[model samples]
Target chain A: MELFTPDSGLVIWMFISFAILFIILAVFAWPAIMKGIAERANFIDKGVEYAQEAKSQLDGAREEARGIIDEARRQQADILRDADKMKTRIVEEARVAAQTEASKVMDQAKESISQAQKEAEKNLRNEVSAFALEIAQKVVRNQLKDEKSQKELVETLMGDMK
Target chain B: MHQRLFRYMVVIMACMILPVFALRGEDLAGNSAAAHEEDKPIDVKEIIFEHLGDGYGWEVPFNHHKRIPLPVVVKGSDGKWHVFSSGKITDHQDYTEDGVTFRLAKEGEHKNKIVEVDALGNETRVTDMSVTKNVCAIFLTMVVIMGLCFWLKSWYKRNGYKVPRRGLGAFEALIEFVYNGVIKSTLKDKAEKFAPYLLTVFMFIFVLNIMGLMVVFPGGANVTGNIAVTLVLAIFTFCFTNFFGTKHYWKEIFWPDVPLWLKFPIPIMQLIEIFGMFTKPAALTVRLFANMMGGHMIVIVLTLLIFIFASFGPIVIGATSVVSVVFSVFMLLVDVLVSFIQAYVFTMLSTIFIALAQESGHEEKHEKKEDAGGGAKEAAAVTTL
Candidate 1:
């Protein structure tokens, strides 16, 4: 029976102690602790948000960087292809110009050579005619002394003409 | 290697229990009918009850006759207050002062309590407001809690809400665990409003329960096992649950959304709701008290087994002592676990109760009608606590 009994002294003390503890803690401790905890929680939340924002911004920057690099590579490829085509065309044009100049030089050289050859042939023929005329004159003079030789030369020339 | 270690530990434990066995053998030798008052047969019931109950003084270890007395405050029959050390009355002697006599009653209904006697030799109770063992223990518990709470506060104050290091960090973890796990999850937005009381109760009960496990100074008082203490805690829960309860809570209790027949005529649901209200706190009170008291009682009973086996000679006494020590040690460890659990359960239940009261049924009505069943289920969950 005594075991079941609730002592007033202990009850009063317990109530007083509990109330005092609650009051003291509620006023001095709980609010501070709770406020500190809540503030920390809020701080962590903001930190996470900031980190995520920074990460997304970094990702965007990286994407932009990738885009810039791709554009530069594309421009470089186009410029390289254009430079290769220009090099090919320029080489082909130079080769064609050299071939035309060589051909024109060769034609001019052939014309000059033919002209020289013609001149030489003409001179040779004139010389030959002249020599023949002179030879005939000398023969006529020498043969005047001899009427038979002159007469024989004239008859041979007539027979050749017939 | 582990097995060897274990054998060594058992041997060491047996060595420790040997002295206790020798002491009990001496005690059993005086168990004859003509023995002295201190050598009387062991009263297991008295021992268990005494250990479970609050005392006017803290019992000294290994010395049943003497105790460290506390101050006794009582009002005499002469309508005046008397203050004295409890040792004066607990020494099996009557204390007389200013024409009034007070004595601690023995072998009667008022046994183990201070009673006032008059010229007619009739014993009547005094207004005892002593700072007994339990009260002192409460003060000790309060100081410890204050130390821990203020330590945490100072840590936060200095560090600006950062997680504290080491033991203080563990303490913070416990606080956060209870607050976030039980209170905040259950009470939702209203958690902050009632967190102070709930957190305090949790710490109060937890520290008291752990402190009760100690057999030495500052730890031996069974404060939590007392009915009065648990009742006060329960009453606080009841007050908080009812006083801060929302309008919807009261409406649900008096006029629930049950069938019309259950609400009217017989008023079956209403009665059950009212009954459920008291039952919540009642259950809280008894559950904590019984669990703690039972834990303490089992340990004491296990210890008494050595004395019970003393008549069987040294062999039986030695065997019983070893078994008893091992079991009691195990039981004490279990009690430590129970202490934390009971504290957690008490706080969890209180949170649920407050959460139940904080529910606003308007949401259920404004939303789909099917959710109303969920509300009733929630109420049922609270009653199960």
Candidate 2:
């Protein structure tokens, strides 16, 4: 019991010493310690927030890059399709031009052949008429001489025919 | 290979620490043995009590004496202060001068009391405000703690808000553990405000407790184990809680939210609540004091067992010494654990009391809205209990 019993001097001293220690610590030590801890906590929290921001930004950049790649692929397919269409159009146009040129040449040859045939037919008709005329002239020359000599005889034959 | 690595670490740590522990025993035994005269049988109980209780000097057992006498300051009946060395008192004898007598009365209930004798031979008592061993220990604790705080501050400045490095790194963990684990969890939003007080108290008590276990002249004084010291710490915590208590907190204690029938019969709840306030600090005082004292006593008693066995014969002494020393060391290790635990419990309880007395943040805001005075003045009122 005496051990627990308070000594007035020691109690007074205890109160003084303890209060002094508490006050001094409150002013000097505790605030500094608590501040250090609080500052560190805030710093760590900020660090974590910044890291999260960086991660989201990276993700956004990746998504945008992927979008760009997709656009490039689509453009490539469009260019290939346009090239195929141009190739087919050029081939069709060239085939059509060659067919028209050959038809024009064939029509000219047919016209020339028709003209030549007409000219040849006209000459042959003229020649045939000349030949027939020559043969008739010869026959008329001989028959006319005989016709004059035979006038007398014809008179007699005419009398008999009458 | 891993187990080998582990063994190597164990060996290295043991190599570093075991010698210090061995030297500690040698230092205490060597000094005590040299100090005591062979005329009287060594009384283990008395020796233990002497070590546990406060004395007029520090106990390195130097100069073939039990203590190195500290300064004695006493106010004499002549209404003036008389300051002298405690070495003035002769061994077990009355010392007289200037018609005033001072004697070291080491018998009866008031052992080591400073008794005064008048010129007419009438005996009286004088107020002793001397720095005794326990007081000296308290002073030492303060010095060590103050030094540590300064070091921590500079570390903060040098490191620039970084986690402490080197020796302070270990201390930072303890500070953080108490802040995050104890103060923050118990005190919540107001934790930062009260951290300085609680942190200081925790470190002071813990350092004092660990010093008690050191069992050497510079290291050994049961400051925290003393009832007076514990009471002072408890009183501080008590003042902190009540002084800063909110109106809501006081209301919960002074009046209860109960039915009228119960209220009229007797304000049992209020009475109990009042008692609870005093008991809270009282419990804190006793818990720390008893735990530290009990642990020290156990270690002493265990070590004393070897001496008791030595009375029979050398053979018995030899057999018991091994067991006794091993058990004593184990008890000391347990004491070391209890020291930290008691310090932690005291700080933890103090925070809980403060938290209970604090108003939740929303209630504080609502109260602020209802008040029709200067916000700062009202805030000050809330903190004045």
Go through the candidates in order and give each one's DockQ. 0.69, 0.51
**Superposed model 2: Cα runs more than 4 Å off:** A102-162, B1-41, B61-66, B117-125, B259-267, B359-385
Instruction: Report the C-alpha lDDT of model 1 over B205-227, residue by residue, as the tens digit.
Output: 99999999999988988888898
Best by DockQ: 1
Q: Residue by residue across A22-141, what tens digits does model 2's lDDT show?
A: 788889887887788788889999999999999999999999999999999999999999989988888888888777877877777777777788778878887887888888877766
- Evaluate residue B115 in candidate 2 and report its C-alpha lDDT on the 0 to 100 scale: 65
Report the lDDT of model 1 for residue B270: 90
Question: Which of the numbered candidates is closest to the native, going by highest TM-score?
Answer: 1
- Using all chains and alpha carbons, the TM-scores for the candidates as numbered come to 0.85, 0.77
